[model samples]
Target chain A: MARASGEAVLTRAVRILAVFEPDRAEAGVAEIARLTGLHIATTSRLVAQLVELGLLSRLPSGRVGVGMRLWELGQRASPTLSLREAAMPFLEDLHAAIGHHVQLGVLDGTEVIFLERLSAPGSVVNFTRIAGRLPLHASSSGLVLLAHGSHDLQERVLASPLERLTPATVTDPRELRSLLARVRRDGVVITEGHIHPEATGAATPVRDRHGTVVAALGAVLPNDGRAGGVVAALRAAAHGIARAHTARTSDSH
Target chain B: MARASGEAVLTRAVRILAVFEPDRAEAGVAEIARLTGLHIATTSRLVAQLVELGLLSRLPSGRVGVGMRLWELGQRASPTLSLREAAMPFLEDLHAAIGHHVQLGVLDGTEVIFLERLSAPGSVVNFTRIAGRLPLHASSSGLVLLAHGSHDLQERVLASPLERLTPATVTDPRELRSLLARVRRDGVVITEGHIHPEATGAATPVRDRHGTVVAALGAVLPNDGRAGGVVAALRAAAHGIARAHTARTSDSH
Candidate 1:
């Protein structure tokens, strides 16, 4: 097939990869073609080339999955290394205290991409995994981060449709704005039954030395109708991570 | 400037990224060009494209480092996701008890690439990092994995040049062979001063339900002449992770 340039092919390859989600780990050629909006033949050819280079692995049934080499390279030089490293100790402490799912999330474009997650074996039912993404209106971490996000980002998100995961999720822009206002004023967010009917989310903003909100540290707990010191724990951990990150930033300089 | 295909460009991008070490986060265009064996102009062009794609970021001094987007994508669809997830809780327990540098490593070809690490603030001086690589003969995790690795793979490493990192590092093939044999027999490896003079590493193999060696669970401790129950802790944790991974594997099916 004729193409524009090498760069265009690379971009197409990236788009093809973007089709696979956290839940869908493997995909057949036809499914990939349909999802990526590329011709099946082109998709097949690209998948072959990527598999050849170990950027993707072929399953026994010939479907493709993300390659270990790709993951290795990503880990080798990830930009979020500093923040993830800084928050990990605190995430551990929080997970120990809460005995639930503790997550560290950062604002990635318009989504809150979880950087790290510490989970207990039989804790709250949280579908959030490391590197998982959640909408700005359906998670407490998202709300805390979005509250401190840029004005343009806020307006852009408010302009878009907010999908609801549960009936308790705030989908109305006006209501979401008010919720964000509360998060900004209170320095923490407690969203009940947002992602799951039985779970509640609490999050606090993590900041840098200059007091710039860098990430949201959060935990998913049983919706027992009480904050149960989770707010205090998250805020304290956020503060600890912020101070650590700030010190690390200064050390790097 | 010219190239073979778009795939070649992706290959070149990976090569450029391969120049960075965990200790060295950022590099100048000239250094990257020299290390990647590409013309400076071509290297600059590729760097610009990568930066635009958010796979690499530019530093204040015009150097480039790994980008956050690249890291996020890597984590989102990594091959080691399940193993890392399954081992996290047990790794935390081991870390809490020992309070050193607890790491999870998987064998990638002849190298042991760390998948996750939990480090205490003033723990041992460990060179191993999350996503960092260690030679198959230079770390305890590497030794444990190599001990259980395929015969062909083991032969290949033993036949190659065995680089020495410290005085205690066994470079003689016969000695290494014996050491590996001991690891296999004892079900663990304790490497003293292999990576550093002051650090001792202990590691054990973690197997999946199908009895495949999936990962190495290990820790770096002070080389203070006593294993100090660290070995027991690691083995217990490794056993726990293996069972957890097996359960997850069964559940997924």
Candidate 2:
């Protein structure tokens, strides 16, 4: 939608890229134009320019996907690289211990963006995917991050309408407030069937060197009493990740 | 460098982001200004704009680093995500078997950009970091990809001035040609001390469903004579990655 003659180039580029989502990673120019609400000619031209810059590439089906260059640039610019690296070993341990989905997620705005996730083919019907997002009020990782997030962020989320994903998703502002407080007090949260009818999410906060809660280490498992143990395992792994993160950051400094 | 009015806006934005590297991940406005060759005031304004967009964020020390949003955007668009996901299980297995730095890389332009790496703290002295880049001729992963790459790309690399990184780096055109030929024939490349004197890089090509060499799977280890076993492990892992990749692509189709 940034075809205005005087609009910033970066804004237009971001708009074009913003069209690609988890479910729709590749799209033809016509679909992209429709989704971005940009004129077909303008979208085509911008796409061409992006391809030239290696920010986008053509797929075998002639659809454009994010280019390797963007990935390289993101690799350089993505501030989460170190955090993800720090959390990887612990994530592996947690995955082996839990035998379900193990994920490391960071709070971005009011949502949790998963940086890494380890899963098996038939693991627990978990909705979490690497680079995917989930609402802070519903998902376990989101709950942990939001519990340790800024008051302003918490207030903003509370003020906004919490969209319901599944029937069990906690959407009431009052219920969510209490949930956030409990997550803070207990150092963990286990929400049952928020994303699916038969899955439960267990999460714990992961801190940085400065003791700032930087991420949420979490697991998605079948709804059962097993979440308590998963929470303990998650908390232990979170502690390890936080220690590793601190060590790496301090070393770099 | 693209500050000229009416120039591509994305180009200018890229220039600002291009200033950040693994070594220079966090930078002050003045340094970024110098690197991007933009006016100090202009750089600051653009930086502010990018920060507002969450493409960049200010660090605790008041310097700018890549924002989580950029990583998120990169995650969505980057073509390497599927490849990285497909290769992870095998990479972990290879790492456990070899106890060294295992990495997956893809050819971007003339360089090999590493997408993921698994390593222990005191593993081999690796110059390769996740999302880091190495010159095509100086890294084993690069050599494998280049060997299987197009004739045009091979010719272009040979024609270019190859900058030597270490004493073992092959810069001579005739020598490099033979090496590339050997890698194609042998289905693997073992480069010793091209990046660091104590490290040896052994790599093999990973194919997609259509049997296209889409990436290079490799490992960095001590420059001892024990490369044969590592090569065998790498080839097996590469085969696994290719199978997973093909399955994924065929599923998506």
Candidate 3:
């Protein structure tokens, strides 16, 4: 057996855990080793350790899967869940007021990870998945988060590969840089980008007490060009969320 | 510093992470050591290892807090997040139909941990928090889970202390035992327990394809003495969630 540093142990544990995504829930030890590029013996040993800790569990059929213990720990640490709880009443109002797809998202590694979404019956179809990722340059919430993100983060994202989900997606780094600047000035983003060719979305940044952008609240409408009202509603909802966050924090302390 | 076994190291790591709950998000090294009953040196070393792995992060004010990386990894492993995604549509429908608080919870340890909750404005005020825990003998979802839980789990919860949250809470072990039996045979739990005297909740078990209870779906309503309609709606919604879960798994595979 090979000896690993304490840091290596933690990193390997995280890598092993990351192999289970929304699309892929279960995997065999050999598959995990291949996916994580760890030696088979090292992978198996670490996995057995995790199973012992109750962070992972093996099914009777022999495939290893994420255990309920991991889920419980994650649920405990989820700020997204807390934010959703705080914003639910306001989100419900926004959803009813807008009568479209209402979503809340936060920036995660240059992508927008949706925290909550409310859609009406017979609303436009959306590809966004809960706990799923979307390109920062393509979605409305992503645009808002990217615009408010730090300069270094913006540059890092621009330097990375920008996947074009639709023909209208802005893949040019320079162009996206300027667009983000305009979004910062306007405090809103109205996009008809890659997600739904026949749909448009308006997003606004939800801020904290120090005026830092924490998340984005947005609404998606059909691409028939009636977006001004939806944009106003989204901005109001975002402002309300910021106010609620401030109030809750102040009261808690 | 004292050395720990591989299993001990993993358990210690989990204990360190568990110290940062929703209420206590940040703490210093000494505080964590005191909370977990570990030596200061050992706690500091473990915290450093976790920070290096991005599971914990150092705040600007010098306190340690749970990191976004931890949140990301946890989100990946969360079965509740996946189930919530599948059940959101149905939950929304049920909430709309009933105009009340619709919630989803799962068994965690000896308590019921709320996974997701959807409530409209003017709904009954209940003290259920997302990711918060309630005793198995008190909450409606808790009862449903306890009824369907393994025999060991039942014995463990029964043998432990059952705190009474309200006058109506079933703290008597004998009574709780009979209630669990009734819950299993009836397939639903309608109770005015633990939360409020004015609120009644009806919960039903959500089964996976294997017919094992994976979760409990319930609705909280004002106890205006109308329980029959709410009970029927909760059972239907639970069935809907189970069907959706099966469909989602089949589609993913």
Q: Which of the predicted structures, 1 or 3, would earn the higher DockQ when compared with the native?
A: 1
Second chain TM-score for model 2: 0.95
Q: Write the per-residue lDDT of candidate 3 for residues B138-202, one digit (tens) a residue.
A: 88999999999999999998998888878989988899999999999999989974567888988
Give per-residue lDDT, candidate 2, residue B181: 93
Q: Score the docking of each candidate (DockQ).
A: 0.64, 0.60, 0.49
Candidate 1 runs further than 4 Å off: A1-4, A59-61, B1-3, B19-21, B27-31, B57-64
Ranking by TM-score: 2, 1, 3
lDDT of 1 at B78: 78
Model 2 misses residue A239 by how many Å?
1.1
Over 4 Å off in model 3, which ranges?
A: A96-100, A119-127, A159-163, A195-199, A220-229, B1-5, B96-100, B119-127, B159-167, B194-199, B209-212, B221-229
lDDT of each: 0.86, 0.86, 0.82
TM-score of 1: 0.94
Could you give candidate 1's per-residue lDDT for residues A1-253 as a string of tens digits?
4544656666777787676666788899999999989989888888988887777889898888988777877787676788889888888898898788899998988989898998887887997888888898789999988999999999999999999899999999999999989999999989889999999999989998888998999899999987657888888899899989998889988
Query: CA lDDT of B151 in candidate 1?
Result: 94
TM-score of each: 0.94, 0.95, 0.88
Q: Judge candidate 3 at residue A213 and give its lDDT.
A: 93
lDDT of 1 by residue, B29-94 (tens): 999999889989879988888887877889888899987766766678777788888999899899
Residue B30 lDDT, candidate 2, scale 0-100: 96
For candidate 3, give the docking quality class from DockQ.
Answer: acceptable
